[model samples]
Target: MARKVGIYTRISRDDEGESLGVARQREDCERLADLRNWQAVKVYEDNDVSAFKRNVRREEFELMLTDLRAGLIDGIVAYDLDRLARKPQDLERLIEIYDDRPRLEFATVTNDVNLGTADGRTMARVMVAFANKSSHDTSRRLKRKHLELAQQGKASGGPAPYGWQKGDPEKVDQEAARHIKEAQKELLAGVRIGTIRTRWQEQGLGNPREGTKRMAHHRVTHILTNPRLVGYRTYHGEILYGEDGSPVMGDWETINTVEEWEAVCAVVAERQKSQPGRSLARTYLLSGIARCGLCKSKIRGQTNHKWQPGSKGARYKYQCSKVNGGCGKVARVGEPVDELIAQLALEEQRDRAASADVSPERRWPREQELNDLNTDIAQLIEAEKNKSISVSTLLQVLPEKERQRDELKLDRARFYKEQKQAEAKDDAVDLSLEEFFDLPIERQREIVLHSLSAVFIHPSGRGKRVFDPDLIEPVWRE
Candidate 1:
């Protein structure tokens, strides 16, 4: 009886599609099996897959191991020693497998190597070590190339961030460009970072894989803080880098003007200055959502009168830090301002809901249509190969099939888009205008605080006053 032999073959991505090489390897392995008087049980081939990586996800390789462990194969044959593995870790795993199984034997054709002796084991280790070093060197070279490209303002890997598009020298994507402009506009208009996130989610923008329907506050903050938006590069946690081997201005692809960038930075700086020594013990219903319309700074709360032995039931007001040198405005007390803003916000929400349209469903092809088209494409290719149809004729027919495929894809995309739009309409919160008008002043204040991004009160010699949106209307409405 002949020994059952498992034939293994592997090729890295660098060696992919070399038909002659693959054929030679297969032939060599088959010949080795024959010389050993072993019946070839199965052939495991992983094309365009790296052996250097652990936990091989290759289907055929896994099946071969399953059969080997089941005692279905008594020996393994390969074209060359390197075909078994080029990684030291993977080679060690193979050696361990062989050591534990007494019946199993490993042999290679071109190398005339046998993994049954100490000398052979040492040789295998040396080969694996060289292969691992080669893999590491290749990885380092690729990283260097990527960094070089980044320095040249070229697309590296991942999707382009919010302000930029994916392409060479010029060719900016119109859709991405529009979103970037809108984000900048919103920022300048004194919209709170949290509000911007909510708006993005409501608009169905940002990366789909992030699993967020809206933009996050942190993401908005990151956008604001990113020097790239101001046309500079930030690398390795530092803004300044050695351009031409000397310290130079950061590599930022400026999207905003210098004045705009300075203004934004000033606003941020001012907000920080105003909030110094403020305790987190103070909780406001809409702390994160409020923004100063003038400098777009966050409005911090200050107690008008302490709840001590002298004062009880005293009020507090939310005022702009004016960090950009103070809008010279006083803050609005908790009661009146909060009520008015909440009512206005609720009204705006209601108006938005009423005006939104329920999008209609788009027609799309069924799954069977797609499957049948794919089958036809496969048949067409087979027919062309067999010379049953002329290559030119198939080429002419290919465009029609490709067009149909593209159309189907577009239709599916549009269908889902319409579905999302309709769902958004249904999800909107509806509040009556009359209810907003009739609500008690305090309740109205609460609604205002919940809804409005911020309320600005003009400065007064006296302490607190009712909130007025008029003083900062220019910034918010812009």
Candidate 2:
């Protein structure tokens, strides 16, 4: 009786999006099965996947093994032994399976294999070892070549970044670059990065790396945070620094300054420390902004769990509780107070234009100091590299300088965010007042943070259930 055979085929890449190469392999394997007088039961193919790379999943290969173990196929046919596996562990599994069934047969279109015999298994193992060696050597060479290209600030041949023209690192796409800058500004101004991502998707602002397929939340953050936007070469998410301890600037026309990049990175890092998706669960309009009038602690918004389905009571309220280090003295209903606070903030914006209290020329006074600190640090590293300073001295000085630089970077980031918020508040007032309620909670809170400094909720008398707007005191910013 003819043995039932399963044909296996694989190709590392299907550039044309069609499995034509694997299809040819399948034909050849089926022909081999016919020559051996075996009935071809099924064909398993893994396309655009590497056999050598252990990380790459060979789904069809695994399924064929399952069928082999089930005795559904008494024979296996492939184009070559190497196509079966370049990894030794994979070969051992097949050999073990073959040992379980003495009648099982394995053959290839390119080579005759009798896996029931020890000699055939040894030969197959030797061939796969050589194949594994070849893949390792190729991987090493490619990694070296990639490092060399990155050192020279050249693309290592992939999809272009979102802000740059495709396949051209030196040229900047002005419109795309503008969007990146806007993303940075929006992120620092307290707009959620997810919101920016959705906006970009709606606007069709995609690139080969970003918008072409999908713009996930992490990918959107990557575009905003990558140092490449400021004309620096990066590899595997790390900026490559030169021997002088400075970043290797790329050939691209820069979209943002170093200061802006530093600031945005600081903001991203700070946000990462808190629950990143907390904004999505935000229930109250003025949770963190509302304070306890007695103890001066931020009030949190909470749902009144005491009210069941049929109960008539406040569903949510802002409370200053002792558990969170508040005096446990103030509580008020959520919706009416939220509406009044927002209204008061809007009135503050309409009554007076935003004032810097100083001219634009006087802003950012510490920029020069920041530059000088960087210059001094770079000079020290260069001095140490030239043997002008000893390693001991270099290490001693660099830590403190680095600390100061990091602290200054943080201070600058905060100042920039504050200034941007003030500017955003001006823009907020420019919008129709009716639109404020339509914004996301985070945006509304951000606008209120700039327009009004604080909302002091004075305690309502005990048993006073009526909603009172007079008890809420809003301190508008000067």
Best candidate (score: lDDT): 2
Best by TM-score: 2
The RMSD of every model to the true structure, in order and in angstroms, is 20.7, 5.6
Model 1, 6-109: lDDT tens digits are 89887765322454565667888898788778899788887666676667576666677677777888878887767777777667777776777866878888
TM-scores, in order shown? 0.37, 0.72
Q: Give the TM-score of candidate 1.
A: 0.37
Encode model 2's per-residue lDDT on 59-170: one tens digit a residue.
9999999999999999799999889998999999999999999889889888877789999989888898999999899989988998888888877775567787765757
Each prediction's number of clashing residue pairs: 19, 1
Worst 10 residues of 2 by lDDT: 206-215
Pairs of colliding residues, candidate 2: 206-211
Error of 1 at 212 (Å): 12
